[model samples]
Target: MAATEPAGSRHRNEAGPVGDQVRANLKFFRARQGISTTQLARLLEALGRPILATAITKIESGDRKVDVGDLVALALALRTTPNRMLLPDYGPSRGQADVALTPTVTVFPDLAWAWASGKQQLLAAEIALGHGEESPFEVLEEFRRNALTTAERQHADHTAVRAAEAVLSSIRGILDRIDNPVRYDVEDESRARHPDSAARLGPAPATPEGLRARLRSLIAEIDALIGDDSDG
Candidate 1:
């Protein structure tokens, strides 16, 4: 029989800083869902790893060492990605954390939800400033203004910051396309068919007689081409 790794050494990481982030996220998410330690343990057990309530308390209190397998299990039970549990760099870091507030973790779901909501608002703003609409430029200006206001002082969370950036980036693209339209030369069939004749005529005839002469010459040229084709 193979000897199993010691119980304490089974899943512990050499660098224990990862444990702090995981424990924090696990406690925070679990509390938000109003799940008791017993309930969480049962959920983890149901996910193919049996966990006892005491084990959960020890993990949260930093008494027990949490391993990679345990982190994956906890993340699954909490319905969040493992990165959210382990990575503390998901949000902007402000120097070193003090003892007052729990550091905010910018989970992926929150960012996704904020982006979807901002997209809907941007769509409405686009309709308000669409082509041929009254005061369309003003509408875009007002939208940009409101977004700036929100970005500057409205909120402090990472989701809020990312959402604001998304709106501004989208608005800038729309404005750029509007300002720089594609240009093309007007297609002139007369110029294409008879460049030499057009040059000789010198800027087209303004008078009725000149117009009639031009038309007659064009008709004669067409007739000659048709005659040659029939002969051939």
Candidate 2:
């Protein structure tokens, strides 16, 4: 459970600067929900807190101080979390320590899922390759599929996605060309002897470096997908 702060430390809800952010958040949420002060007051009353419509007006207009319980209650009535009602609007604070504001990183749900799935597929591919059970082309295909899914969901950069799609098409063509190539040829025997050493072997058709390059391209595409949800 979260430890509660002292009452005195709470945002002083008067007109100057103390509770400006909370007031703005409250007004924005209320107006966005099309809930008038009277309706909100009735909703709060239904929640067992009998606040008047005048009090709701004063609270939203930054003319009245809001208690901790009232803040939580108002947030619940607005159908939002308390933290959402308390987010700072990137404005100046009172005479306190100089605090630098940094951009908060947030991950999109679809991209996050694709990232986790890609990692699992990569680990499985590595294990399968070590056991000489699955073709490397099949692993690359899975990587391409994951990248395509993320690209479709990420509406940030269309050009990067198009390039990746073209590259994937080329890779699919190459994969189809050698769909049933012999796995244990004389050349492969020579390459297998130096399996542990990536340097001694020249660039083979299915070198790990080639796979790493594909992974890097996919990651670059994902990086280009950086933006906030509001942009959509």
Candidate 3:
């Protein structure tokens, strides 16, 4: 029998369009960065996973295969992200061309870029291509639900942060007032405009003991907000 290829080796060697794109991008980015193959190899060596300059040249020439680790290393050496290296040129003029994702599957460059950049899912592309029997709306609704949940959580977190920042700003203003009570007449005028604010603000703490008490209360409020955020 002919000698068998090592397990997984054949797959690596036969990496198709995706691999070709990565190789092309590797060369593009390296040239843009004005780095030679020897320099890139040295950078990879410094990263502790050395690839020979000859191997880097072969990878750029599409004669050598790059595994995940090598892909990451090359990205770092080239000062670009792995997704950038994985995607074909997607300029406006080039966007009309289809990028071969596999031997059989090709997608528009923009769709390929979106998928590679994590802005959209491959399932969306499959649905767009009418490759599945499932209702597109139903499949997309599921993704929408997931995306909405993530967006809502992010919004909540941002709101909580803003609230905390406002509270901290109030505390800092209070401290400044304590430091120079006569300098902040604007605050007093505001307090006068909204008399109910004084009840929430409390009388400006006059002494060291009063300031300590105010700081303690503010710290407690911050802790409570943090606890609620963590629970959420």
Q: If scored against the real structure, what TM-score would every candidate get?
A: 0.36, 0.34, 0.53
lDDT of 3 by residue, 1-232 (tens): 9999888777534878889889889888888889999999899999988999999999888788999999898888888888888887754342246788876567767667655643345664574567676666766555445544676546534644545544554565566555556656766678789999877867655435445655666566667756645566
Better of 1 and 2 by lDDT: 2
Compose the digit string of candidate 1's lDDT tens values, residues 1-232: 9989888877644335557767788789999999999999899989988789998998888888787788889889999877667654322222323221112222233232232333222333344446445465565455445544566434423443544454454444334334432211121355568899867755333334444555555555555545545566
Indicate the residue-level lDDT of 147 in model 3: 48
Candidate 1 local Cα displacement, residue 175, angstroms: 17
Candidate that scores best on lDDT: 3
lDDT of 1: 0.57
Tell me, by TM-score, which candidate is best: 3
Which residue pairs come into collision in candidate 3?
A: none
TM-score-superior candidate, 1 or 3: 3
Better of 1 and 2 by TM-score: 1
Comparing 1 with 3 on lDDT, the higher-scoring candidate is 3
lDDT per residue for candidate 2 within 1-232, as digits (tens), equals: 9999988898843344336657888889988999999999998999887789998898876667777888888889999876556553322222223211112222322223333444224443255347455576776566656654665446323666655654564464346336424532555677677776634543453444554565566667666677444557
User: TM-score of the candidate numbered 1?
Assistant: 0.36
Give the range where candidate 2 is weakest over 10 consecutive residues by summed lDDT: 96-105
Tell me the lDDT of candidate 2.
0.59
lDDT of 1 at 79: 93
The C-alpha stretches of model 2 lying farther than 4 A from their native spots are: 1-18, 89-232
